[model samples]
Target: MTTTVINHIHETTTATTTTSQTQSPPSPTTTPPHHHKQPPPRDHHCNHHH
Candidate 1:
């Protein structure tokens, strides 16, 4: 189902953006950090908490 792909993307993108590049962008305009930060607690808390 399409939901499966969306879930996979949500996990992978947030995980990579967080762990792979802590210092990803110095600009506050970049949304990657915001997206990464929000998902850890909402959708991927278990994944990151591990």
Candidate 2:
């Protein structure tokens, strides 16, 4: 019974951690930097296409 309770607590913490991690990455709050990176490649592609 104690073991099961401990296992449940551990599972909950792990699940919450994984859930937070999965949710954290899509924030688009970081997109400005990503867009800075994107323009270089896109302009490179456009220059090459030209």
Candidate 3:
């Protein structure tokens, strides 16, 4: 009777804790930084006069 109730409580607490831990968001340090897209290369034209 009492033992069964206590066991049920313990199981519920354990399950709640495990769920909360798993659902928690990851830390910032674990995520990668966002980078901007690179610009296209430019063309250069040179004229020589002698």
Worst 10 residues of 1 by lDDT: 20-29
lDDT of 3 by residue, 1-50 (tens): 99999999999999977775665334322332211222221112222221
Model 3: ten consecutive residues of lowest lDDT: 34-43
With a 3 Å backbone cut-off (N, CA, C), the pairs that clash in candidate 3 are none
lDDT (Cα atoms) of all candidates against the true structure: 0.74, 0.80, 0.54
RMSD of each: 15.6, 6.0, 14.3
Error of 3 at 25 (Å): 4.7
List residue ranges in candidate 2 displaced over 4 A.
Answer: 28-50
Alpha carbon lDDT of residue 13, candidate 2? 89
Residue 37's lDDT within candidate 2 is 71
TM-score of each: 0.41, 0.44, 0.44
